[model samples]
Target: MSNDVEHAKRALRAELRERRQLLSDAQRETAAAAIGARLDALVDSIGARSISCFLSTTTEPGTRDFVARAAGRGIRVLLPITRADGLLDWAVATDDGEIAEGLHGLPEPTGEVLSPMAVNDVDLMIIPAAAVDRTGMRMGWGRGYFDKTIGSMQKCPPVYAVIYDSEVLDSLPREVHDQPVTGVVTPTQTLNLSQTRH
Candidate 1:
């Protein structure tokens, strides 16, 4: 990666982190509810019986409600478990699943661990992002986990990044390894930012 792009990404991620930390409890609750509804609708629209979704951190937009509701509806939800090798493992999401802090302090499922290939079966993917540009370029939180996962898939599904409404920008700093999303789901709306997704 070029030094300029790396520096830009670092600065943007820090600003986004600070912004997320500043959200009030009430604001987070409202955003979580709205995000859950939007995600549910997105899943239904795509008719995805199996999907991969990230367990959100406290500062990020919450997906716990959607994960619970999706599991309740009998949809197979795969939660990510980060690996030390800079990859992500997989676990099935359940209403009563135990969550433990995984690598990088991210929430992870404490169930039977599946290989990274488990994600290949998912019909859709909902991931976390600091911001996404109008063209579907996703700026993640400095970790290349999602980017590597998507890039390694033989048949990648429609990947959507969930972020706050204000995080949608006209453009963003891009690197060769930064993966683009098919769309974005915010508290208010869902936007399909790319036409290349199959």
Candidate 2:
């Protein structure tokens, strides 16, 4: 990507992070509850048994409720383990209490380390996002973790980014390596994209 596009993404990320940080605890809790319901509906609608999902930071839309709910329902949930080289490995999240502060300062699950390609075994994927466009273009934290993971997959399940409703946009600056997502889940609804991918 050009310097200008990279710069624009940085500015947008900063703005969104700031906005998320400004949210009050009560607001965050309510949003998390609503999003958890939406996620449950999606899981039921798709009949997802095994899923690759993320553990969100306090500032972002909370996934604690959803993660716990999924596990309680006997759904297999996998959380990302950030590698030293910036790639990701996988671990099964049996309980939220088992998650501790892991690599790159994100909450990671405690379990047998699944290889990076383990994501390919899942029914669906849910990722964190700074924002995403209607076209399914996801603006991640600019780490390229998901970018590389998705790119390396020979056959990837549907990748969805979870964000607040206001963060979904009409478009975002793009680059060659920036992989668009399959859809986005927000407090209001899931915005499924019309793009085709494996």
Candidate 3:
């Protein structure tokens, strides 16, 4: 990526993050609950037994409730453990337990490490993104972790990036390496991109 492109991406990320931080605590909680309910409906509609999902951070769309509810309902939810090389390792998500601190200040589950390619076994994948365009291209935080992870999957499943409703965009500063997602799930609806080759 060119320096100008990288700069643009960083600027966008900062702007979107700032917007997310502006949401009040009560508003964030209510939006999270609604997203969780919609997610549950998506899970049921697809009958996804095993899913690869991310653990949400403080300012992002909250995934704690959704992760727990899915687990409680017997869905095999897997959380990513960020590796130093920018690839992610998979582990079963548990509702109760002290989460281990992973790279990028993300908290991960303390469980057995599955192969990085374990994503191929999942029926669905829900990841995080700062913004996504109409063409399914996701402009994530600078690292490109999810892009790398998804690009390597031999047989990828339906992938969705969870974000606040306002994060959806008509276009973003995209790159060739930026992996496009199958759809994007927001507080209100799921935007499925039609050309999901994976």
Candidate 4:
């Protein structure tokens, strides 16, 4: 990653963070409901019995509704628990799963921890992103956890990043380690941006 590209990503992330912060509580709820519906449809279309998803922070597009609904439908939902070594451990998402502030103050499941390789069986992955470009290149929130996970998977599934509709851009700064997703799920629609789904 060149210094210029790194600088650009940092600036863009800061701006996007501010934009998310500006959204009112009502706006967040409406967007969360819309996004959850779209995600449910996506899962049905893919016929994914098991999937990996991230618990959204307050500023991010809410995914708790989708997670809870998915678990209720008997679709095994795995939530990522961030590891100290910059990797993610998996935990099954339960309707009554307790959430605790983990490393970096992110929400994590307080259940029996599974290994990082626990994500291998997931049929799909729904991850977080600062933004994603039209080409599917995801600009994560300066953390390489998702990038590393996607890159390391031997039989990676269709990975989708959830963001606001406005966060889907024409282009974004990409580094060599930055991984592209198969699609993006926004409040209004789900866009499949890559042909590489497996």
Candidate 5:
């Protein structure tokens, strides 16, 4: 990454950390509702049979409800597990009983690590991001897990970023390894990048 891009990422991270601290419990609930609603719309639009998403931690935008809703609707939901080498492995999440702690304090499945599935098998992948740009570049949590994971796929799935509306920006400094998302859904809107120039 260029020095300028690295600096911009750092600044954005700091700004987000501060902004997160300022949110009240009620505000967080409202934001989650908005995010869930938008996600529901996206799911309806895509009519995907299977989807993969993350179980958000407290510091990130929570998406547990959305995941549950998808599962209830018969979509096969997958969550990313952080492997020892800092790469991602996807595991199916059918019920609350399947989850356990993985590397770096993130959640993973207690079940066996299945073989990596083809990107075409995954209709949608909801990614976690610290920030994203209108052009679809994603700024993750300083880790290259998602980048490496997406890079290894033979056919990339349609990637969607899950974030608060405030975290979406006009531009974000990105490196070549950073994979751009196909669309970004916040509490407010879903920006389709397939037709938008980056």
Candidate 6:
């Protein structure tokens, strides 16, 4: 990463960390409900049978409730594993379970990792981000893990970014390796970019 991009990432990360800390219990509960509703709407819109979604950690948006809801409805769920080289490898979550602390202090599946599935096999993928724009541009944690992983997929699934409505901003600085989401879901709205060019 260039020095400028690296600096931008660091600034964004700090801003997000501070933002997370400022949330009151009531605000967090309301935000979680809104996020959950948006997720449900997006899932219904896609009508996918199987999905590959991240198991969100506390530092990120809460996805456990959403994942459990999906699993209850018979949708397959997949969580990512960070490989030795900092790339992501996905595996299906065996059953309803809690997030186990893993690399970078992110939450992952506690169950045994299942056989790998082709990316195209997943109908949808929910991505975590620090910030996103209306045009589907995402600002991630600067690791490029999702970018590399998504690049390898023959058929890219409908990518949905989960963020607070506040995180959707006017624009975010971009780099060549930055991957864009196909859709964005906030507590208030779900913006579909597949039909609209960014």
lDDT of each: 0.93, 0.88, 0.87, 0.94, 0.79, 0.76
Which sections of candidate 4 miss by over 4 Å? Answer: none
Off by over 4 Å in 1: none
Better of 2 and 6 by lDDT: 2
* lDDT tens digits by residue: candidate 6, 41-82: 777888988887887665566777878888888888778876
In model 3, the runs with Cα more than 4 Å from the true position are none
lDDT of 4 by residue, 84-168 (tens): 8999998999988689998989998888889999999999999999999999999998979999999999999999999999999
> Which regions of candidate 6 fall more than 4 Å away from where they truly are?
114-117, 194-198
Q: For model 2, how does the per-residue alpha-carbon lDDT over 1-198 read when each residue is reduced to its tens digit?
A: 499999999999999999999999999998999888888888888899999899889998989879988988899998899998978999888864487789678888888899898888888889998999888888889889998898888988888889999899899988888888899889888889838766
In candidate 3 the C-alpha lDDT for residue 63 amounts to 86
Give the alpha carbon lDDT tens digit for every residue of 1-198 in model 3.
Answer: 577788999899989989998999998998889888888888888899999888788898988889988988889999999898888889988767348788778878888999788788999999999998988989888887899988898888888889888898889887888999988888889889738656
Better of 3 and 4 by lDDT: 4
User: What lDDT tens digits, residue by residue, belong to model 5 across residues 40-94?
Assistant: 8888888878887888776677787888788888888877878677767777776
Candidate 2 or 5, higher TM-score? 2
What TM-score would each prediction reach against the true structure? 0.98, 0.96, 0.96, 0.98, 0.90, 0.89
RMSD per candidate (Å) reads 1.0, 1.2, 1.2, 1.0, 2.3, 2.4
Task: Record all residue pairs in model 1 with backbone atoms less than 3 Å apart, i.e. clashing.
Answer: none
The model with the greater lDDT, 3 or 6, is: 3
C-alpha RMSD of candidate 1: 1.0
Off by over 4 Å in 5: 118-120, 194-198
**Model 5 TM-score on a 0 to 1 scale:** 0.90
In angstroms, the error of model 1 at 155 is 0.6
lDDT of 4: 0.94
